[model samples]
Target: MSTPKTTVHYVEDKINSWQTRSPFIILFLASLVGVATGLIGSLFQIGIAHIISWRMGIADSEFSNIYIKCLVIFLITAAMGAFSYYLVKKYAPESGGSGIPEVEGALLDLRPVRWKRVLPVKFFGGLTALGSGMVLGREGPTVQMGSSLGKMLADTTKIKNKESQHTLIATGAGAGITTAFNAPLGGILFVIEEMRGEFSYTKSSIKAVFVGCISACIVYQLIIGSSPILNIGTYISVPLNSIWIYIFLGIFVGVIGALSNFLILSTRKFLDLFYQKKEYFFVLTGALLAGFFGLLTIFLPDITGGGFLIIPNVIDELYSFYPLLILFSLRLIATVICFGSGAPGGIFSPTIALGAILGVLFGICARTIFPEYDIHLGTCAILGMAGLFAASIRAPLTGIVIVIEMTSSYILILPLILTCVTATFIAQTLGSTSLYSEILNNTLDKLGIQRK
Candidate 1:
């Protein structure tokens, strides 16, 4: 026993002693990347939460006059939106969108990863944009910022090898996602499954991603607590006899997903035409957009923000069929506008919220028609999330894993799989492509930067 322990120690020491971008050094850098990414991601979440709570509190508060309250809300959100839009437009133009495409382009050497400009712009811009009652997610800024940190660290450590730099950058991206959803496995799978063509698969690269993901999750939990990202809560298992119902649910969700993608792309083109007319007007449009959403937060709170709070309410069956349908339509429109306007935010959270709404809608109808069978509405909401995401993003495995890890519905893995696969198949059959891939191609076309 003593000899075995000594040999193990010897091997560890020898590995640690290796330098110059060796496996040990690379992995060590990856952990550092994770720690830093987690710290920034936690801070971003905290700040956004504070901003939203403060804004919404006043919106819901009883005031002497409603006009004054509306004006105050509008002004506050407009200021935040203006600030965010100005930062991205003036400092880092590339920080305008999800930033995932930019990172992917950097990995393919088709785009520049200017960390110095991106870090501050994406961080502050995303914080303000997401907090200003915009229907946006935090994952976009965190993922981009995480990858920026990877590059920053590589440059600081004088790691000139391109492949090693790629490893660290990819690690940071994974770690950032892990921090966002508190899902380490989901983060790693995002890089592996979603970025399959870009990420280099090697024993060391996979190990680095694992190390980064674990470290990021540990640091995030240390600061934010180890809680599930969504509040749907654990639901009971679904009956096998009712499994066929999920396939139809998936088909519905896939149609919605594909429609969402088309709307976003078309919206961007339409908005770009406006920007061509006058750039400052385009920036001011962000402020006006934020102001409108802020007003809605007071009146129609259902469609404001990233839909995190509303998801639980929908899952608990708070709305009737007509109300739910209206909410879903408005939210889908809001999500597309916010993201397509080139706001520094993610579509992930809003997309999940839409799925939950669809799920609950389907559940209500199903239970009414099939009163004999036990239909779990909450379970449908969960499957809606995974299915819609898989369909739109074209990454079924990542969507399934992410929903599983975020919701802790491990017992429903089979259901999740069936829903995601069916959803992706339907989306593809309907002529829908991966959302990010098309966006990246469009950007490259505009810039005349051909992919290498």
Candidate 2:
């Protein structure tokens, strides 16, 4: 018979304890976390680029015979996807999808950070899934891995201060985005804006975020060079007369962003319903989707892969209205399916591309309609990216900063702000909650984790 106190203690809810008076030590550890995150993020970026290049090379050149080429591509991609899903299922299920939700849950003490399992699984699994030509981004995995690294260091160093741990994790996450997109300020703002209610903002925590972002930026620049993430050439600021046009663009992408979120949530529930009967089918489904997208990559590469590389082309108006529309529709579907299927990747890159395409399409019509005013199509594409991101993530400031940083289009800050803010307002009015927050809530509910 167990003692009453022991029984009570065993059943009691666990809480993370906090401490103070270690600002210097926490700052130092935060820098270390940023460095580690940067190194891993850079390597992850390089690895994915290599795999994508290899895959594209084979598709473009090697197998002259169509059947043989298709077979090889399918086999390669299917194997990659299978391996990624297998790792998520066996080693770390928390790494199954865009890891941002898990990190958010961790921040609020609603989830566990199994770093030992998450680090390797997320690094390799994300690499394989994104490399296999899925419409996914590396940023999500990097962020998750960064938070894990923070927790790993805390655990190893025996840092029992819960507040310090939270700060470190926040720092790591901020640095991870900086490394992923080469946007230090945007990364810092992301932590402040997107994580507003969750983060315990303090003087030391803010300083730690800054230090971590700068360190991550430096490390990433050392490895990946100091260039912006996207090579979309800068454009002249939109004429005052044309600024109002972007509001329409914002409204359009906002509605689409809401629909995208709905689709993602719906797909997850539908898949889970079917998956409950046969757990083994999950990996099979992922591999099949990868193989299907691999084939699509050969036929029409625009709709396949993360939307980063295609941004420059879209900005340049490479695709006409009909083709761009088809590409956008196909990619929207692919992005939602790939992300919703529990693949360890992100929706950021894909969303950016879709927004750009949609923006360009809208621009084509706008230019024709308003022949009196000079409108820049590329600028419209950039506005699209910012607006959609702001709408989907509900972080207008972060979206504006990240768009400017990624494209180095500083002259259009005013337009970016207009688009982002309007889009956010429209999204909120339409009842489209934050994507990551919704994902986190759904995830916690599914796991039967209650938080008040």
- Which candidate should be chosen as best, given TM-score against the real structure? 1
Candidate 1: RMSD to truth: 4.1
Model 1 misplacement above 4 A = 1-22, 60-62
Put down candidate 1 lDDT per residue, 238-322, tens digits, no spaces. 8898888888888899999999999999999999888988879767988998899989888888888888888888887789899
Model 2 C-alpha lDDT versus the unseen true structure: 0.89
The RMSD of every model to the true structure, in order and in angstroms, is 4.1, 7.4
The 10-residue segment of model 1 with minimum total lDDT is 13-22
Off by over 4 Å in 2: 1-22
User: Candidate 1: what lDDT?
Assistant: 0.90
Prediction 1 TM-score vs. true: 0.95
